[model samples]
Target: MANPVLLNNIDHKDLHVQTGRGAMFGDNVMSALTFPSEFRDIQACYPIVFRKADDGNFEAHALFGFQEGENLFLGMHGWEAPYVPLTIERQPFLIGTNGTELMVHVDLENPRISSSDGERVFLPHGGTTEYLERVNSTLLAIHQGLQQSRGFMAALLEYHLLESFAFDIELDDGSQYRLAGFYTINEERLSALAGAVLERLNRAGYLQPIYMVIAAMSNFRTLIERKNRVHAAQC
Candidate 1:
């Protein structure tokens, strides 16, 4: 039995609530972020993070690039953000189509204390370092095609992905699950969609392994695309 229990009623104590301009987000996208959000006032809402970084370290701003759409910038605590494009003003950041994935490097440029807490200077590293590290590792694993090497890729491709298969999430013990699927979703609609996924998934009360589902989402379009797309490269 999985210790944490992968089910509808997941405990939210650790689940990060995105507000106050904290941690950025990215999607396991090949083509583009499915259903991109319409963010109008961006030059506003500066990035805010709780983690204080140490001095003498450099940080680099990188985003998982896309070919057709705008590349969402990863800066200010890995928050996937939008800005007036450096290359094109009319066009927003282009999230590279069929991204192999991006590995944003943070060298810890400088450190300073956030207004809230003075003891800890905000360096390139903060509370997000741990989560960002994990994200980086997963992106690396996907890029290396390690799953195929491990022999789990074939079966996994079929189970958790494909929009044809929808999910219902059910939260137990009256636990509140506020769904914010990608920043683009509206208040009423985002709630509805999350409720639906949770309800469909929670019906069973538990998942044998949740990681498999995550794996499927990450590889969904890529696997299908590879199978369908005619390429010059030999199989």
Candidate 2:
């Protein structure tokens, strides 16, 4: 546990705490563009391992709940599945994150093929589209669930509930692709997004305790976005 470092409350810049112990939850987590080498190789387990580690998949819906909880407790719930290993099984790929956004880099022996799970794998501008299509469908399900969920009061509340998720797909041969998981609730930047949500929910007279948090996250998201965008532009 990296010495179980005591990260203070102030240390929480955006309250993005991952729950899994070894691979999923670690201090080594960095921007999607980069990952530690140890995580980049998996001669045995492939897509299944990578899928579970990625917090953006439908299999990972509870990840947001895990994040909200980890905002308070360092230990978020570890995602588990039958084929999934308790330990993060490397799958010839790397998964990186920020807030609700995600990125995945796949390292394949073959230069021209794209694949997921145990499929035969295909090439760029090909079956990769299927994976992307599925991600879109999954997100639609999430949004539909959000729309139909019980507690929503207004568009503001609904928008605030939306989380940003992006994917960067890379192959071993340096071939790459990307897909947007969810459109930000509004084209507006983070501050505008949070403020609109909080004001709407507060006026609605619901989730007061949660509103206090929404207020904090409002500023946090803005700051993180500014920092990340600047860093990305630099890179």
Candidate 3:
């Protein structure tokens, strides 16, 4: 469970956050919830896929490993990927709503919270530090991006562009694993759409992200390679 509280300069003036990537800080996860607005950057290193949320609505995610609690991107030096999804980057912090106004909230139980070392959250005079400012921006982006994704997902469902998929992954050591319960863009359906429909998607600024998700499929090979390397080391 998370213990989230509204972040204030008075209560959190001495707070510091450990920004390094590690399983100890809860980075050992197979996937992270992502938004369409970040598909481009996420596609560069992760395979973007969709899954049904608890509310039975489709939500996007960036794949990191084949199995639960496994994150291939995490290593001794930190995350090996060129880009880290903002969802993963924003740790111990989340957006909260005070009526119609959005506010920053921090999890008190997260291991990243530190009183000494790491990035400081406030200055000596009680103003926000550069790191805290960046976190604020990240939280705002996540909030707005998720809001935008609601429309994007509705459009996909209206067009019947999402399909369930499963992958049978074979490792170099002859081990096999099944990856399932994920959804992806149906290219055949997308190609078969009428020109006017494509125009609507394009005009709505969803075409680029659609293509980005397609491009990100190529990263599965990279993910397998990382898994193979880890398997070899373990053997």
Alpha-carbon runs more than 4 Å astray in model 2: 1-148, 157-166, 171-177, 185-190, 193-197, 203-235
Superior by TM-score: candidate 2 or candidate 3: 3
RMSD in angstroms between candidate 3 and the native structure over all alpha carbons = 0.7
Provide TM-scores for the models. Answer: 0.17, 0.21, 0.99
For model 2, the run of ten residues with the poorest summed lDDT: 42-51
lDDT of each residue in 202-230, candidate 3, tens digit only: 99989899999999999999999999999
Q: Count the backbone clashes (under 3 Å) in each candidate.
A: 38, 1, 0
Q: What local lDDT score does residue 196 receive in model 3, on the 0 to 100 scale?
A: 100
lDDT of residue 15 for candidate 1: 30
Clashing pairs in model 2? 114-122
State the lDDT of candidate 1 residue by residue for 136-197, as single tens digits: 45444333432232222122222332122222223233322221211111224323445656
* lDDT of model number 1: 0.25
Better of 1 and 3 by lDDT: 3
**Which candidate has the top score in TM-score?**
3
